[model samples]
Target: MKTPSDSQNNWDSLREKIIGLGDHSLRKTYYPELQQKLDDLQQSEERFRATFNQAAVGIALAGLDGRWLQINRKLCDTVGYTEEELKNLTFQDITHPDDLKVSLEWFHRVLAGEIRNYSIEKRYIHKNGSTVWINLTVSLVSESSGNHKYLIAVIEDITERKRTEEALRDAYNELDKRVAERTAELVKTITALQEEVADRITAEQALQAEMRERMRTMEELRRKDQMLMQQSRQAAMGEMIGNIAHQWRQPLNTIGLYIQGLLVPGECGEFSKEHLEAGVNKAMQVIFHMSQTIDDFRNFFRPDKEMTLFRVDEVVAKTVSLVEGSYRCQQIKVEVKTKGEPLINGYPNEYSQVLLNILINARDAFLEKKIADARVELRVFTEKGKAVVTITDNAGGIPAGILDRIFDPYFTTKGPDKGTGVGLYMSKTIIEKNMNGRLTARNTGNGAEFRIEV
Candidate 1:
């Protein structure tokens, strides 16, 4: 074996001889391949430079100490600073004071290898003394030995987008305010409409009430007109009766005088006592009949008068006296019983009319029944602090079915010509409404009883 240095030299010489043999052939073949690889590397470098320089987002390489080691043109333009000026300052110099701590904390995290990348939107001061809002993305780059070497930061301007967002929010708020205002206006309008509807309903109700009142008034007027017509007929009948009674008055008086003259004694001035008494009694009967006829006429045409306190017995007596002649002819007995002389306050004429109406009804009842021994009883008394007068007749009783409506206007059991049907109704009105008294009627066992309480 040769020495180690001679062996290494022999190997080097072999390598040189091999290299020398291929110098021209290698130049012709491997030189083109080497040139192509170099061109590919240059092209890749150009593509990287073009991509970095033309990016819209600003890119920067910063040292671990936060100094700008390199910056793209976009970053220089975004911060309004030259590359040389930016390299002289640290990232903390341009960061807002309020954002600086948070940004440094994040940077420290990246340096510690705790986070791969971080992003934040923060405000920064530009070279021209204006504020810029930007979104920043930071990534940590380490050496192959795992030492924290540099940080890559991507910055994007977001001031216009933030302002636009704020403007949109303001517009939405304005629209909401306008909608609320319109809703309030609509609510007020609805309230007004409801009020108007209520007012219209009230007015309609009032109108209906007024119309009802007018109808009631018209019906009352019609009733009054009918009453006037009935009264006219009654007046005419009363006038004819008055004339007939007037015509009989003188002849009846003359007959009474003649009879009385006959009762006087001749020459001796004292005749047989029985004969004189008989003649005098006959004369008395004539005078009584004449007197009753005159009273009937008087009562029939009696005028209305103001209210006054009067004895009930007196009113009853007057009513009975007015119809006595007619009753005497019919053989109807009249019985009167009173509890002292009870006084009542009322319109005397109207009260008299009420009594007269009841008496006439009793008379008609007796005639209709045709009872041989018909009788009418008039009783006056006080009950429950009220003056009461009861008129009862022994005759055919009223039918039970028609009794309830007997007091209604235009209701009567008698024939139309014999009874106007208004007598009881008018009597009820006078006693109840005019005199503030009560009048009622009910059928008894044999006949009917009419009661007046004042």
Candidate 2:
């Protein structure tokens, strides 16, 4: 063994001889220069051996057959062996079983010239029977002729590094599990929310459909009510015209007889002023009454534009006169009594029509029942600042069964050809709904009494 001092002195001598050749190499003599170059090569080999013995990393030289030919102090320390003990052992003797196959594969590839060097992490068994992890790098050392030779392997202990990698792997696996669990919970919550939204949409659609159906039903009812009202008014007009014709019959006949009587006095030359005046006066009186009847009908039949102040008694009196001639023809007596002229703000024509409807119903009752000496009494008075009118007939009251429903639309006691059934119904509607008054009927000893309060 050469001491480190002998190697150091040889390297110093080579440096001094190379400096003597100095600036340019071609200026040096040949044989002496060759001798200096050989000396420098020898010194480099000595320095390499010194570094290999003292290196901290393990270094070893092995045969291509996996036998250890040379090993440094660090390699012996890493394997828990002295140089003499490791010298007899092949690398395979201490390599762990699991790492042996891969380690051999790399060695063979290096020998075959397929690879120049290789690095791997492998396990080796120390002499003390403990395991050691190491990073091993094998470099191929071939002959100048490219023939396969020994291999040089450099190794570093890495037990702590391998343990750290195992702990990190466990932590990554746990994190992955927690992420999967959270994702599953989110998916479940989203599904529930979607179902709730779908149910609410269905309910809203059902509600909208129901509302549309109700609107259609209401429109149909309104149209029916309108048609019925127009028909009722037409029926009342026909009845009023018939009464007018009845009133005109006697007056027209009397006027013709008076004209004949005047012709006799004129043609006989018996032109007396008294006879001419009396005959002319009687004819004029009949004409005046007929004109007055037409005027009254005109006022009562005209539609009112808006509410106005009018006397209830006067309205009642005019309404009675309209049917006065008809009542006498049927042998029915009508008496009208009033206390004071009660003024009210309302539709007077419509109010008269309501009274007409009631009186006509009474007259019809008398005719249908063939009641003799039938009479209808009308009373107009004021009660508590409100106008009141009542019409009582002696033609017998309505039957108990349908009396309560008289004011209902399309309810009637008369036959279909005789009445439209909406007469009394429309009367009640005009008084109560249109005029903001009350019209009610109740049975009395004499007949049915209809009361109007405004």
Q: Which of the numbered candidates is closest to the native, going by highest lDDT?
A: 2
* Clash count list over all predictions: 0, 0
lDDT of 2: 0.86
State the lDDT of candidate 2 residue by residue for 1-454, as single tens digits: 2223455688678666765765445324555666566666778777888989999999987877787777899888898989888878899899999899998898788877788999999999999998889999999877678776678899898877887887888788878887888878888888888887887788778877877877787788667666666767787788889889988989999999998998897799987989989998999999999999999988877889999999988888889998988898999999999998899899999899999999999999999999988999999899988899999998889898988999888887889888888888888878887888999999999689999999
Model 1, 227-338: lDDT tens per residue?
A: 7436733843563364456546555777767666665665557767677777767767777866666666565556656778888898888767666666776788999999
Worst 10 residues of 2 by lDDT: 22-31
Give the TM-score (vs. native) of candidate 2: 0.54
Show pairs that collide, candidate 2: none
- Model 1, position 186, has a per-residue lDDT of 96
For each candidate, give its TM-score against the true structure.
0.52, 0.54
Estimate every model's Cα lDDT from 0 to 1. Answer: 0.79, 0.86
In candidate 2, which residue ranges exceed 4 Å CA deviation?
A: 1-218, 272-278
- What's the residue-level lDDT of 362 in candidate 2? 95
Task: Report residue 263 deviation for candidate 1 (angstroms).
Answer: 12
